[model samples]
Target: MKLHLASAVSRLFSKILRLHYSFFSGKILSVRAICTDAENRIYLVRHSYTPGWHLPGGGVDNGVSVEEALAAELREEGNLQILGKPMLKYVYLNVEGSRREHIVLFTAQVSQPDGFSRNFEIIEGRFFSMAELPPDLDPACQRRIQEWVIGEFGAAAW
Candidate 1:
């Protein structure tokens, strides 16, 4: 079922707030991948419940392996199936929302990308040429693309 953005956000924050009130000392791990088509375009998604376009991925739930989490997220968010084993790219410390959050990044070739239709969780999904990323791309998401995809690891403006 398609959830309204406010409703989805409420559900998410409600769950997290529950944990926040409890005695918790756990790190949040999320998986995001640089999934490229055969033509070398990267698949990015804009969520119905969130702003900005980003690489297709999500949080790894308990009892699920990191790779499995990535696969499932890619499938759900982009109608993508990894063509082969995903290669570990990098792990980023995402300090925007919480100190305990970490993002695991991977790279993979994918298929069936054309099947991605707008769904409840996702507003849109498509492959983007590196030279033509959207203006509203998340800063951190754009940074990862510049560093990892564009091979600009150390280019920081001082």
Candidate 2:
């Protein structure tokens, strides 16, 4: 009976530890722009912090609405105006176990070519066709992009 009690206690401790690890490891909420041009190219940014090309967005600020976060990230990273409403929202759990909730993705059209000088957090930015996406993009970003593209344009077409 004592041995069984000890095993149960051990299991409870393990479960608590797992929950603590999942909660306090830090979480980030990010917004991404699926900005498509008339040519159907999507704007992606090369991040200085992460070694991959990602959508023009970043961590959402505390107390800010998702739409505000998306707009702010777009202005800060891409230096271009987002002209429309958000088309999709994705929740992505990265490999590091950090959760990004409500990764608001906006689809907009840009007429002027804004200079991408890598300010605030972005290192480089450029537009690429779906087929020409960079190989080193973040896994979550890639998945969101693929899902967005498929939803906007039919899977058979894109």
Question: What's each prediction's TM-score?
Answer: 0.81, 0.67
Clashing pairs in model 1?
none
**Candidate 2 wrong stretches, greater than 4 Å:** 1-27, 93-95, 100-102, 111-113, 152-158
Tens digits of per-residue lDDT, candidate 2, 50-70, equal 468877766677799877887
* Clashes (N, CA, C under 3 Å) per candidate: 0, 0
Single out the weakest 10-residue window by summed lDDT for candidate 1.
149-158
Which candidate's TM-score is highest?
1
RMSD of each: 3.8, 12.7
Task: Report the error of model 2 at residue 16, Å.
Answer: 25
Q: Judge candidate 1 at residue 122 and give its lDDT.
A: 79
Candidate 1: lDDT over CA atoms?
0.79
| Backbone clashes, candidate 1 | 0
